[model samples]
Target: MKVSIKREFDFIEYEVDMSDATLLEILHEIKTNQENSLAYSSGCRSSVCGSCAVRVNEKEVLACSYKVQDGDRVEPLKNVEIIRDLVVNMDKALETNARAKSWLAEFNKETVLNHEDEKINALQSDCILCGSCYSACPVYAVNEEFLGPFSLTGVWKYVSDKRELNAAQKIETIQTNGVWDCTLCNECTLVCPQGISSKADIEKLRMKSSMAGYSDPNFGQSFGGGFGFDGTPSF
Candidate 1:
């Protein structure tokens, strides 16, 4: 099978013969047999670490989990700087998380949580920070300042916590460069390996922002206002 990889150096194609193998397996085979210098990143091959994320046919997926196909066009995750062959620099995602302050702010460690809230939090907390949603996001492509799906979803997780009293502040953080920027494309929801719906989480954030008195920045404006050249107001 022949696979094309878009590396930082150039577009390099490799051939590998393997049956019932994952994409990362083929990559490792290429590195071991064909080219000794091929570079990629992977850990916890069980899809828990989320370090083996890449784009197969322009869609983000976990290389370690996705089955390899013949004539596949494999590439590094988009909206990021490629560090090597399949590896990308995740510094931007890390920086965004810090800026969003995805962690819980004030909480008494002594407080015990009930089962219901814990269950809800667990659903959002299972995120592995794979950057798949970040890579799959279209908003980040045009606007780098916008907080991508994973970051916003992380914010939602914290903001929804029963222990959180600063929901208003967190919602404010998401209103700018966060929820408003999302096109609600649902790409992040489809590609998540953990079954987390970043789109839905972001929508919830948008609703919360509206309740917080933050409206869409362009709620009333149109392309050329509501007036036509005939002096008639256009709807």
Candidate 2:
């Protein structure tokens, strides 16, 4: 099988003797035998660590789990600085968590979650921080500061918690580059390896925002006479 990997400014193609192999395995073979300088990241080859994530043919996937095929074009994730071949600096993507304050603030009390309550944010808790959603998000193409999917999903996880006393504050924090900025295109949900729907979580956040008397900041610009449409009957 022949695979092409993006190295800095170029895509270097390599031939692999093995046919049935994971992308990570192919990368290992290439790095070990073909090119010693080939660089990629991997851990917990079982897809648990989420460190081996890369883009295959423009789709985000875990290299540890995805089986490579002939003529596969492997590239590093988007929307972040690429430290090297297939290795990106995740610090910027992770910074959104702190910027969005996706953690529990002002805990109400020591409350144990019942089975029902736990299910509220259960799917969201499974995020591996692989940054696949971050790559898939289109908002970053124009607005890099817009908090991406994983962070928003993390926000949902804490905001939904019954014990979190500052849900309103959390909602307020995401109003600018936070929740309202998301286009609801569902690209982030499609790329998440954990099956976590950041789109759904973001929608829930929007609902929560409405309940807290917050609306999209662009709501006025898009409506309410800001669009040059006066309250006149044009029919």
Candidate 3:
């Protein structure tokens, strides 16, 4: 079968004997045996690490889990600086978590919990920082400073936990460049290896923000002149 890979400034094709092999295995064959210069990232071939995320046929997927087919197109993850062939820089994407303060500041010991208390945030906790959701997020493409789906998912996880102490402050922190900025495009949800619905998490945050007396100023407004203007004269 022939596999096409998009390297920097070039599309390289290679025909190999990797019948019914996983994408990662195909990449391995291409790199170790044929092309010594091919570059990609992978860890834990079992798909637990999420380091093997790449765009297979323009869709973000964990190469460790995706079985390769004939004439497959493979490329680096999108909307980031491509350091090398199939190896993109992930610093900016991971930084969103720290920027959004997506962590538990303090836990409430006094809060009583049931056996299934953590179930609300179970989905968010499954994320392995694979950059798959980061690669699939559409909001990050247009808004560089937008708190992305991953961070928003983290926000929802912490804020929903009954043991968390500062839900109100968390809600306030996400008022700008956070929940409201998310178009809920569902792109992030589609590519997650863990099946996390980041769009749904953002929706939960929006609802929480509304309950906390926060609102999107651009709500119901049309985009015009770099402002959310609804065809109204402001003179």
Candidate 4:
């Protein structure tokens, strides 16, 4: 099968024998025999580590699990600095967690979650930090500072926990470049490898924000200067 990998300035094409081989395997073959300088990242080839994520034909996928196909155009994850070949610098994307304060603020000593309570944020805990959602998110195209889907999901994870004491503060942290900034495009949800619905989590966060008397900052701007007090349209 023929595969094309994107480099810094160009796409390099290669031909390899791909008999039910995963993309990671294809990369290995190319690196071992064809180009000793080829660079990519991988660990826990079973798709557990999430370190081998790459984009295949504009779709985010784990290289360790995705089977290679003919004429596949492989590229590094988008919206981040590329280190080399398929390797990208994930520092900025990962930093969103800290910026959104997505960790437990304070523990409620008396709070013990039942099975039902645990289910509230169970799916969110499955995130492997693959950054697929980050790659697929459109917000970074315009506003790189916008707290992303995974970060918002992480916030939801802790906020939904009955043991967390500062849920309201967590909600407040996401009010700006956080929840309201999301375009609700659902691209993040579609690319998530763990099947976690970040879109739904974000929507729940929006509801929580509303309940806490917070509103979308863009709401007023979207309706600015159109109405008159005399019940007539202002031109």
Instruction: Please give the CA lDDT of all the candidate structures.
Output: 0.82, 0.89, 0.84, 0.89
Backbone clash pairs for candidate 3 read none
User: What TM-score does candidate 3 reach?
Assistant: 0.91
RMSD after CA superposition, every candidate: 5.3, 4.5, 4.3, 4.7
Q: Write the per-residue lDDT of candidate 2 for residues 1-235, one digit (tens) a residue.
A: 8899999899888998997899998999998999999999998998788999899999999999999989999999998899999999999899999999999988877887899999999999999999999998889767889998999999999999999988878987888788888999999889888999999999999898877766665665567655534322122
Report how far off residue 114 is in candidate 4 (Å): 1.5
The TM-score values for the models, in the order shown, are 0.90, 0.93, 0.91, 0.94
Backbone collisions counted per model: 0, 0, 0, 0
Tell me which of candidates 2 and 4 scores higher on lDDT: 4
**Residue range 46-94, candidate 1, lDDT tens digits:** 9999999998988888988999888888888888888877888988876
lDDT of 4 by residue, 4-88 (tens): 9998888999999768999999999999999989999999998788999999999999999999899999999999899999999
Candidate 2 C-alpha error for residue 99, in Å: 0.7
Candidate 3, residues 1-235: lDDT per residue as tens digits? 9999998887889999867789999999999999999999988999898888899888999998899888889999988889999888888988888878799878898988786986878878999888887778788888878889888899999998988898887887777788888888899989999999999999988888776665575753544334533322233
lDDT of 1 at 45: 92
Model 2, position 54, has a per-residue lDDT of: 93
Q: Residue 65 deviation, candidate 1, in Å? A: 0.9
Model 1 segments beyond 4 Å from truth? 220-235
lDDT of 2 at 96: 94
